[model samples]
Target: MASREAPSPASRGVSANKPLPPTFKSIQDVLNGEGVAKGTLVSVIGVVRDLRRPIPTRNSGGSNHGRGPARRADQSSLTANIDWKCVMTLCDKSIDDENTAQNGATGIELHLFCPQNAMPEVGFRDVVLIKSAKVQDYRFGTSLLSNYRTAIYVYSASAIPMPPKSAKDALKPRPGSKASHVEDDEHEYVSWMYHSMNKDSLPEADVFEEQANRSLNVRDKFSLLKDVGDGGFYDLIVEVIKDPYDLLDKATVWVTDYTENKHFYHHSWDISNAESGRDGDPYGYTTAFENPTTKGWPGPYGKQCLQLTCYEPHASPLRSQVRAGGYIRLRNLQIKYGRNGGNLEGYLREDRAYPSRLGFDVIQKSEFTEDADSRLKDLLKRKLEYKKKLKQQKEAFAGLENTKAVGAKRKDNGESATKPNAKQRRKIQRAQRDQEVQKEKTQKAESLGLNKQVRCESEDQPVSSFDRILNGVSWRRTRENGEEEHLALPFTNIKFRANVRVVDFRPRRLEDFAAGRKMSEYDCLEDYDGGSASGSDGQSETLDSFAGPKTWEWRFALELEDASPKAKGEKPERIWALVDNIEAQQLVNLDAVDLQANQEQLSQLREQLFKLWGNLEECKRHEYDAHLESIRRTKLHMPPPDSSDNEIEENGPEQAGRRPPDKVSNKPFTCCLQQYGLEISEADPTKCDSGEGKRYQRVFKIFGTAVR
Candidate 1:
């Protein structure tokens, strides 16, 4: 929704308050016996930012109200305004060091440094909130320990709730009404949160906790932060607003009892700002917005913001690129979350060599079934190929062999009796064997379909892709079974790393279609980024820019980081990345055993489909047989009677009378039913019939609709 508040009409604007520079602060820095009054309310807005000497008493500035600069140096803390009443309440009331741990809004609040007169003399529920905040210069020793605490400030104001109003409208005190204290509209409650710490009592222990091995979801991941510390390590979250004037001084409150909010993150609270950070309250600190909406999540774990205090160089960027490293680590990282859920966890491992293709086999163990039929099909294929080659060789030498045998017999001139008998028997036996083999081949071919004559009688049989592979060259490999096996592995036969280069390609048109689409190729060249994904596992990266296939240099050899490599002095890299094919890459990640399982599963699926097709063919064959048998019997039974003719004769006449004339014949008919061998029905020479239905529908069932 668009904001309801209009822009400020004032031509001249006050220079917003200056932010405190980075410096150590003590507890005494937030406390003052000087600004205290009985029942004085304070609202929390901005953080009680850094500790620095005040900005030289505001440069002795003129008020722009026609007055010159004041002589005395004014000492004040910085303050920002807030919209929610709940934040004001928390900041105003929770400044006491004891209350800091219990306050709902963690370290994010607005702070003001002003005197008692800031509140109008009602000691009231709603008063004018403090317009400015003063930051105190924090130095070491006694004050340093005190500054370790989190503080809030509140402005005193009368809150007579009538209805929820705009942040702009809510700033104005309702005129003439002494107070707004409607019981239903006013809600105040608080809850306590206890932060657990490590055995060392310091807040810097194992922050990246893997709940049963680092949680795969955001909620589960963040839950580990609680164990970081038990002491007063505050996670201060600052929500940003564009201009500070938009939120300057409003009355707000906070109850000791907190109403639970579902959206709290790492002690960050979402309370109404009017009550929690309003002026008259005692405890709120000030933090300023560097940008319009200084939106940020806690970095790493338990880190509310980048601790400029810990940073050696204040100007360093959040991200950097390094040429070569064992593992590039992010000490602290905050991931964004959306309305529904977090980003899905998906892992991609690419081959450094080839980019276009991948090798894959499904690894659903329970879903796999043994493929007995595919094995059988392959067996049959081998047999057919062997028989074909044998026949070809036999024809090539057929006549020559007979001539030589006959000539030898003649040369022997009435050869030995035993020889003649042996020759005759051998010829007969050879012929008989050939006939038997041919018969078997014919039967096998016939069994392949729903009908007979699957193989052509006069034409040629077309060789399929499957048949070509079976008859052509094949590669074999030795498996773990101590037996030779057939394998179609692309990497085993073809070049991998040297012949290929992995390039992450994205479609250019995708960005045009989607404005927010990420529009660049991601670097997916393997080297596992040198195990950069999961830290160093003794794995170093090998950077090899390949020239051609199988020509990788020995100097850049990658070896196992953990286990010693086959070659010494080689960098350790993921072999999974060396693979060029996608499926092969996945198989490598899953390991060799998984690869076999996947192939087996695919083979099983192939077998199941083959079996199903076989069963369907058998069923269809039986159906055709039954259909043919009926016609044959009808023709055989009566020299004149055909079974297909009788049923149609009666049904055809009835349907034909109602349907429109046929387009071809110009005669109304529902069908022109014809039988292959059966005699035509005598009643209606032209067969036509429609199924039973209402008159209009059944009338034109053959051509379906007769709209006219």
Candidate 2:
């Protein structure tokens, strides 16, 4: 049987009279000892698991602690006696008994009460050896405390040849027990560390390089990504579906990888000089390349869309090169969680050298690249299917519209017409002409080898400039059942022609429209009492204050009327629209920036509009005529009083209304229709329904205007 006694100091090669080198003890042994042998000194080796920042110690019963004359009022003095100590938790290599070890062994808490300057420069996972540590009964249990006499030695992984035997046991699985996947992982790690210390071992830098390259090999399909992983590089192949909408020069695009058809991805990438330094050439070229014009990736039909952010400065030039319908292979993109739910976001890895190498690579379908050809085929197939579906939808919608129109006509006419009217024939002809024009355009594009440049029809049409303003147009109406229904016009890009008389033009200061300006500056403009109406004459009133160095936007109110002869009996409508700096510049032939700096140029713009739209006098004449007609129609409805009844005027008996009150104008002002090539026409009031007031209505909120 083996001897059951610990070796004597002499046998252990230490002097018994002095002290034996503190016997190395497992954390378990120290903990189980319960400090009964409190004076005993021991050594422990552990890995620093965590570190806590040094905390200030409070003064105990000092002047600062009590309200006394000796108490220091200055904050500096109050903290003068406070000491900061850092505490850390350490994990010993010893594993609990096999049964409990599987669940993981607990780490021991170490309370380090050292001077701020004396705190150990240890980090997580650093192997540390604490020598001559005293065992004490701490607040909860036995603890090892380091004092002046204690010596701590930290070892780097490369310095340690092997971990302690007990630590190896802790990491290893018990016999006959189900082994975890990572049970032997520590052994591998130890082997690597040992090899790393050898002169013949691979360089540490090469390991990291290998790891980075290996990460690039990870290819994740869109379907597999549920939650974003730790920001790590990934590779993906996708099709660009939308043109980039720039926000602060950052390109935001929507794309589809086609792995799943139900989802779309959005990605934002920076193309500005803000990154990579304004002076640095991102593309490493002496001359910048011109980007090819492309409408955008096509197809509203496809699967999962993902948003990618390109931070590589070199990729700035690729913004225009990547077009709709283009296939691209993105590599070395870092994945991060999106602010919206579990969506994953991709960012270009700009930290690496040769960033452009990993940037978007446009895949051209060619014989040399079979995969590209296949992808192109798939894209074409999807495009065709989408177009077919769109055609079907258009047919269905047209049918529905036709049904509604026929029903309306039947209700109005009391009978459905068997033959199409001349107006209907003209409309059909116009539709055919539009179809022919579209077909011709498609053919021309194909002939010019510009298939890739062919834009969607919708994209070619102008988007409504009034979309943002019109979004606020809403009203409440009472239904037959007495329920109130809130209604708003659905936003659309449909354009209609209208003859409008410019009523008032107000120039907005550039500072007011400029971003980041104080609200107080805007408040000053809001306090202006001037109305947005033309003077009694057709001419617009010149407000010098309205045109200023800060002016950037122009707002105007217009009295509009339908140009169609069919709307001859309808009432004119009034609308307000804003013209932004860009539109204003185009109309007035002066850049807003230049105009803002020169106040004198504003009068020229105002004069030009006055010439085009006529003066307030002309507008007022048209309005007065319309108002008189309205009053005359109202008077006709009044029944003549019977001769037997005495007539008493509301004004008073003294003035029995010297004459029947002439037609009183209910409208405050009238607008000129001649400027819009329109003339007021008389119509039989009996032939028109009261509800037709909305027929000639046309309203717009212009954004930018130039005012003198």
Candidate 3:
């Protein structure tokens, strides 16, 4: 609905006040409080230097100026629904001189509040005479307000008449203006002021037009929070998701347009149950595991909200008016990279070009009517979508948790070995059962337990294949009615105990088991260097320059093959699991150091590992050395770099890749395995540009199996 222009007071038949003699004060005198005090009624005449369009005021209920009951829906008369506020600045010859010297507007500001459609029709360079305006001292500065007795008179700069000889010839005040009649002295004063001011010479005239045009341009450039980029200004319509927090000079408020930005800080809700390291413990088993605090994050979840800092003048008003769940429009909001350069944040500072007008406003409910701006409509749609997405996320998380509960219940009842979805699980159960039957038949009753070795604490647990352990839990997807449904989960809380034989050990040799630790300023506890292990010599200049002690720690992996008896045609399964310093120390019963120079500890490691997997290390070493020799022979012959393996195999016996000298003569050992995930990309989940399109990857690590 269009806003209605106020009707004339004469048209409304308002009785005129008795004429009073004119008493005008200089703008300088009024501002300095030389004679007039705050709240004192005074009169002044000046040129209209700047003005703003009428804006709807907060609906504070009061008398409706005898306009009958307010019909806010009356499209023809917006004044019937709400009060209007118009702001303008006035400066006369005395103040204009000062403004000219300073090259800015130093005029007295006037705040007028009246019934909607009753705003005074004044324009730039016009002469205005205001009477009975009450001086007000606001927190920001001093200003003038309209009272019941206040009256306004305007004389067009090009149309003011010469001195009138009679009362009938004198100009009369316009409709809706409270002035009874224009005094002859006031008429002469207006005429002289109008002639004295040069319309082309006024600087504030351009300021008023710039402010209006700037507003339209900014609104046209409205952008969603998700599309915001660094070092650009944009206007935004956002929902305040969290209440504004006050700072001494600035305030911060978190808001969202319901679109996710990857650079925004990730907020995890209690239901999402984000993973913490060290086997998914809620608080983590050790201080070395970095856990993100999940408490007190009032979330739309994920990366949907942004924190905006409002400075000084903007902060004061925003803190008082904006609340959680309220809607607002921010103009010329700036986006920039925050400290450390990873996340993006917003900033709102005072606009020095127009200090009187703020860059933000509380969006009134009435403005959201059917004909509202398109930007506002988009904001409303996103808000609804956000609510729906939040609901779906919670439901998906619940479904995953429920699935885990059901699996645990079945395990407790000894039903885990029953027909399972994974074929590998079924094969493992059958193989272990067959071995158990054969052992019972061949061993004497008294010596049944003598030869068997229990390497892991959870040896009594069911033995699972590498395939079953890797696929223990996954993101299950299904389609019904053409809509694909998938669980939205951060990580699954699941672990496994597996019977496996060590077919290969990483570093390919026992001498490289211990590695130099990477030093960092924030490092206090030992970190698990699984994916990132320092391979350089401990005497590197980077480590030697450190003020703290240089150290070496064990970091390596074991490639294990499932040891369960398999069907004649079935293939064995293999997987790699990391063994960090703590787990390695338990397995070898020695502290880590530069193992190549420490023959005593190196020999001890070989002996200790012998009990877990007999002669497995020796077999792996022999195979590795032969493979290296073949690679050297191929390079010495200078074979084409891109030669196929088939061509190289046919070259000669020296180029043939040698197989393991002997089968791994190791007994199967039961060890605990943990399946977890690490985030590979913090980018948007919708984009699957490469293999990293998924945000995280599943990782398996060995834990809790000590060598005897």
Best by TM-score: 3
The model with the greatest lDDT is: 3
Better of 1 and 3 by lDDT: 3
1 or 2, greater by lDDT: 2
Local accuracy of candidate 3 as per-residue lDDT tens digits, 421-461: 55466668977885686454333222223214435666555
What is the lDDT ranking, best to worst? 3, 2, 1
TM-score of 2: 0.22
Candidate 1 regions exceeding 4 Å error are 1-92, 95-467, 472-708
Q: What C-alpha lDDT do the candidate models reach, one value each?
A: 0.23, 0.41, 0.64
Worst 10 residues of 1 by lDDT: 189-198
lDDT minimum window of 10 residues, candidate 2: 63-72
Off by over 4 Å in 3: 1-46, 51-88, 91-124, 129-154, 158-219, 270-295, 364-381, 399-708
TM-scores for all predictions: 0.16, 0.22, 0.36
RMSD of each: 33.5, 27.9, 26.8
lDDT tens digits by residue: candidate 1, 105-221: 222222222222232222222212222123322211011110112232222223322222212232343222222221211111100000110012111213212221222221211
